[model samples]
Target: MKGGPVLILGATSGMAREIARSFAACGHPIQLAARNVARLEDDRADLETRHGVAVTLHEFDALDLASHKGFVEGLPALPDIAVCAVGAMGTQEENAANPEKGAMVMRANFEGPASILGHLANAMEARGSGTLVGISSVAGDRGRASNYVYGSAKAGFTAFLSGLRNRLAKTGVHVLTVKPGFVATAMTEGMDLPEKLTADPKEVGHAIRIAVQSQKNVIYIRPVWRLIMAIIKAIPEPIFKKTEI
Candidate 1:
């Protein structure tokens, strides 16, 4: 393997799984971590068999705030690249009706992912080199009525990655913020997404792999999202609030 093992948090997710495969194909050792460790055993074996690289599985529950530190400490070895593809998007109506649900979405998208990355950042800083990839969303660029709860959380994560990238710029550790426009994942299974704007998991995986290799500070999975979000963000708040997305 060229680089140290590539650690993928929330490995069982569609996007993360594709990313794992992409890295494995490039001869990077793979460490897949998620709550469903058992379910990922077959995937681990497949990656090893297909890519001729080592693949290990670890149990990780993003919501378990207290375990974040131990999870990093328990890794077999520090990874050269770590990708945080951990997130949850609950229905906006449901989240608005339940404060707990809103909090859970917020924690899943921001707090939990941020906590683990924080620990990883410190470790990478100490080692003086590594890459951190955070899978934020284009939804973060603006708050819309359809999914403001999720959007707000992503906004926080985007900002967090930005700050981390700034701090680590001089420390040798690179931080990449990835904003995917619309991805067809289990999380958005039934949603009607625009075909032109939506990207598949594998496409996203490839984009991220390229970004990491090129050390891109920020990326929109489909380049058009940069323009789309730019237009959305430019709308005046007074006019924006009156329309539904």
Candidate 2:
């Protein structure tokens, strides 16, 4: 099924752009939102031609909490499905130097994405139908010494999605929690990532689309991460706090 008109927040990012392409190919109208509309014109055009679908660019600022409601109200059409792929992974060293820098990590990963998705969820609930996908991370499963700043925010986001899902459960809206392990994108270009757990943008896109079709509640992009996170989360707190990831 073509499902419904699709809206992607953070559409300029690697995974979001891939998702836009994947759905556009299936003949769904697309609304892509990001900070720079000018930069994504090429992506819009490519998807429009390749899929013969209508592609519209929307200017969005995730951190602009007050603007989220207006942003959703202004959409040309109430989307059938909304996918949020907006998040940031700041350098742990830089985040440690300043609290202001650290705050951005929390806002970007949790506050901003949650604000938008929360707004979308309300709209869908009113309509009595829709699907919502929140792209979170496995790091949220537990805090590690290496990237707790980023991971902590994701943890909050994960919880928010869970609560949103529960609230909308009877409203006929489907909510999906996506936990991608390690992704090789501009955000992680220089990092050393293991081959076993990392996924490229295409793989993330594919997993999301399939999950949507299946109406899955929670999914780990690399299935093994489900096992890995289980172990990490199961570890005793005393030992976990002592070990460095």
Candidate 3:
């Protein structure tokens, strides 16, 4: 699982791109997959030239379930590791006002990512090797009214990853769940996130690389999030519902 190519789904994402760079720096062949072929190619060239490792690009659309199987089948070889960073966090107000928007958020964060991982998990289990890493969120631990639409989707995704990990435990394939709090990236570019709590994409990238190498099952990128979420989760529902997060 360590030597083969690492396939990064949603490769063009700020976080995923950083993770790809980290792995590429470690001499792992990179298979960059995302909806933007142009961006993937750009990244391919950069990683190859910078890290001196083989980098391949693949066109991937997370919501396209029908295409997922064919996408994996088309890889040059089965990847030793797969990182899923596919997610969409629409505005809470927008998602609350529009059912379609909420549905899209749910699909992007849960259904679509889960569908692709299901395929990858089966393939890896059959081979009795490989690793699956999922980028979830701390919001999933407790659904706040501010972003329930996004949080609920991540909650489902977290549960899915946990179940997948349990099923694959005896199979040799490792599954790692990464829950990051506020990350400084395009996804939260305009928000005034706290400097102490917000993590840089490269910091997240380095953490994920270490977690995978160490075969960790679950990790919170910022350890403070574990304590914060625990307090929120411990609140009584009646009182918690009355307070804003």
lDDT of 1 by residue, 113-155 (tens): 9999999999999999999999999889998989989999999
- Candidate 1: count the clashes: 0
lDDT of 2 at 17: 87
lDDT of each model, Cα atoms only?
0.94, 0.92, 0.92
The whole-model C-alpha lDDT of candidate 3 against the native structure comes to 0.92
Preferred candidate (lDDT higher): 2 or 3: 3
What's model 3's lDDT at 240?
Answer: 99
lDDT digits (tens) for residues 136-222 of candidate 2 = 999889988888889999999999999999999999999999998999899889899999889999999888988988999999999
Give the candidate order by descending TM-score.
1, 3, 2
Candidate 3 C-alpha error for residue 125, in Å: 0.5
Worst 10 residues of 3 by lDDT: 1-10
What is the lDDT, from 0 to 100, of the residue 5 in candidate 1? 89
- Per-model TM-score on C-alpha atoms: 0.98, 0.98, 0.98
Cα shift from native, residue 124, model 2 (Å): 0.6
Q: What is the lDDT of residue 9 in candidate 1?
A: 96
Q: Which regions of candidate 3 fall more than 4 Å away from where they truly are? A: none
**Candidate 2: where are CA atoms >4 Å away?**
none
Evaluated with lDDT, which candidate comes out highest?
Answer: 1
